[model samples]
Target: MFFAVIPAGGSGTRLWPLSRAGHPKFLHPLTGTDASLLQATVERVAPLASADRTMVVTGVAHVTAVARQLAGLPEENILVEPSPRDSCAAIALAAAVIAVREPDAVMGSFAADHLIVDPNRWVETVRQAIVGAEQGLLMTVGITPTRAETGYGYLQCGPLIDGGPLRRVEEFKEKPAADIAEAYVRSGRYLWNASMFVWRVDVFMAELARQQPELHAGVTAIAAAWNTPEREDVLGTVWPTLTKISVDYAVMEGAAEAGRVATVPGDFGWNDIGDFHTLGEVLPADSSGNVVLGGEGTEKPGALLWDTANLVVVPYSNRLVAALGVRDLIVVDTPDALMICPRDRAQDVKKLVDELKSRGEEGYV
Candidate 1:
């Protein structure tokens, strides 16, 4: 049996108003379904990993909400971080804790906010990854790129290992420029780096010791005291001293360069839903290509659109939002804030959150 580790840390500033610091995107049901993203994620992996074997690493502020959402999971399974330290620390902490219990356990780290349309295919792909992980290969599931998406990173794949589905990861590329993204898609040699990883706890800890010794040491110390009364004291003392970095930068990139990483190509429909534009593309749309969310169960319709093409409106306040003759626009109406921007400019929504912080408008943000 394999363990599932979910690193649910991001505040999702890019999806502001709907996703706030107090209530992040993972807590909201952006998908048409009623289940929140984090809950959906746990359910998706339930077939492979039972609730007892799954672990969630989240911040102190959101621990209560996370526990409430995942009520079936044991309280100890919900790992809490005192503060934000990025993916490397969060994932490493979980890995260390699992290592203490079972050193050779095969664990997969998945993001809480990503959506996989085809759960069966996703499970099969992860099964393949687990097979590779058991062979001592650090496995990462790479999505087969459907379009020239500049928002996600890319993984350059080499020849298939042992003449099979598993391929050697040649390089890990950051989010490329428009031309480079287009070129990558056209080449068909690159896969979107979805940050999905699988490996044995011992293997991952060995790699962590080799690549990021300081981070490995810090997490190891915390894990030692995780079940003891000194858990909080150890986490508070050592977490801040650990280097803050993403797992991609601190481990995967270097491991790939050293030919220690392998990837399984997954064609299952996957979307990170990083911004409104991406969410609109994935959600159901009307005949005029308009996507409406929220206010559905209420007395009034969530949105009323006429002659609106490719518009995304999210009226969370249960107020009817009526738009006429609007094309390629995004309207997000919350109780305290209303954001109007072109659909193409959805990626820039984080700028609005930053502006609110600069203006000392924390309530709105």
Candidate 2:
């Protein structure tokens, strides 16, 4: 059986105003669907794992909202972190807990806030990864790069193993510069590291013990007390002491170097929805190339654009937002805050959130 673990952390500061610290982007319906990203993610993996076999690791602040969004999920499956400790700790916690239940289970970790246009192809890709995982290989689903995208990490793939589609991941590369990203795309050996990983709980725990012993020990102690009343006490006492690092840095990169990591290149119309420009690209645009959201099935659109080209506007205040003589701009209006920036500068939207924190404007953030 395959278990699905969704890491529903990350405030997604790049999509500010709409995606706040209290209410992150994963809880929003950014894909023009009624279901929020977290709900959609759980549903998307239903073919392989049911609600009982699925778990979500999120922060304490979002537990109530997460529970409200994922009503079918067991309350205990919703592992709440005392504080943010990055991906390694979050994922390790899920793995350790799963190990206690199903020591030989194959578990796949997927991000909560990504969009996959082709669910059928994605499911097939995950099936392939599960096969690799059953073979004692740590597997990652790598996306075939459609363009030179510098915003994401890349996996340099080696030869196909056993004359099939699965290939050994040669190296895990960081987000490269523009020229380096273009070079990586042109080489045809690089795949975008989407962070979708599949591995047996025992195998992953072994790797964790090898690479991140402190983290492995910390989560093991917490998992030992997970179903007991000591869960919260142990989590609060030990979680903050675990090293803060990404799974990529703490495990996958090192595992790749040790020839334990393999990847299946997937081309199922994947988008991270990292920023407004990327969101605009995935969503439907009007004839003027403007993408408007949050006004579906209503008398009027949430935004109005005249002489505007390639603008992404999200008006969530139930008020009509009008734009004129603007091109390639992102306008996001919420009840408490408004964000405007050039489309090219969408990646820098996190700066606004940081500035708000610097100014002690927590309410707006």
Candidate 3:
């Protein structure tokens, strides 16, 4: 059986006010639709696997919220993280949990907020990754870069396998400068590291045991308590102590460094949807070069970008946001806060969050 894990434990502080601590980005309607990012992701995987086969991993703080967001999933499948550690611990815990009943099942772990327009192609790509995993290769789906995106990490494609369609991942490169990102794009040998992974529960757990024993041990205990009354209790005791590390830094990069990983080229209009600037590429812009998401019928919510272009405006609370004499800016409005920033500087939104922290504005974030 093919099982899926959706990790939804992110703060999404960059999209603050709209995306608060209690309600994460995945739970918000990021695409200007009624369904949240988490709901969309779950629906995308539904055609590939049943609801019973899908598991969502979120924090204790958002347990009720997550449960409400993904009501389609069975209550027993929602695994709550007692505390935030990182993707390494999250996926490790998922692998351990799924392995308990289906030791040989293929489990695909992915973030809950990614936007991939083509679900059919996504399922095809995931199916290929599962096949690769079944053959004892830890598989990752790499998106062919459509532009020189510096905000995302890239992977160098190694030589093709003798008979397989997959290729070895030469190296993982950090986000580079615009010029460097352009150069990497021109090289025709790199792919955006999308972080979607597929592997047998046994294979994943074994890899964790080899590369991250401490995390593996913690998850092992959590898995041992699966379907038991003490699962949540034990998780609360061990989760906070786990280190905060990405699965990329702790496992994938390490495995690639050891030369035992494979990549499946993905070309299904995939976007991690990490930042507001990326919304421009995902959403359809109007003839005036502005993306407005709001309104219902003739009086539907709408944003008026007068004398402005190349901006994304997501208006919440039925508020009309008007922009005049502005270009390349992001105007996001929520019930409690409003943010206006240049679209080019969208990558620095995290800095804004830090600045708020310095000013002791914790609640705003």
Write the residue-wise lDDT of candidate 3 on 69-113 in tens digits: 788889989988877788998888889988888889998888898
lDDT of each structure? 0.92, 0.92, 0.83
RMSD for all candidates, in order, please: 1.7, 1.7, 2.3
Pick by lDDT: which candidate is best? 2
TM-score of each: 0.95, 0.95, 0.91
Residue 121 C-alpha lDDT in model 3 = 93
Off by over 4 Å in 3: 162-164, 177-180, 295-300, 304-308, 323-326
C-alpha displacement of 104 in model 3, angstroms?
A: 0.5
* Candidate 2 ranges beyond 4 A from true positions: 295-301
Q: 136 in model 3: Cα distance from truth in Å?
A: 1.2
**Clashing residue pairs in candidate 3, if any?**
294-301, 295-300, 295-301, 296-300, 328-343
Ten consecutive residues with minimal summed lDDT in candidate 2? Answer: 294-303
Report the C-alpha lDDT of model 1 over 144-225, residue by residue, as the tens digit. 9999988889999999999979999999999999999999999989999999999998998999999999999999999999
lDDT of 2 by residue, 312-362 (tens): 988877778999899999999888888999999998999999999999999
Q: What is the lDDT of residue 135 in candidate 3?
A: 85
Q: How accurate is candidate 3 locally (lDDT)?
A: 0.83
- Higher-lDDT candidate of 1 and 2: 2
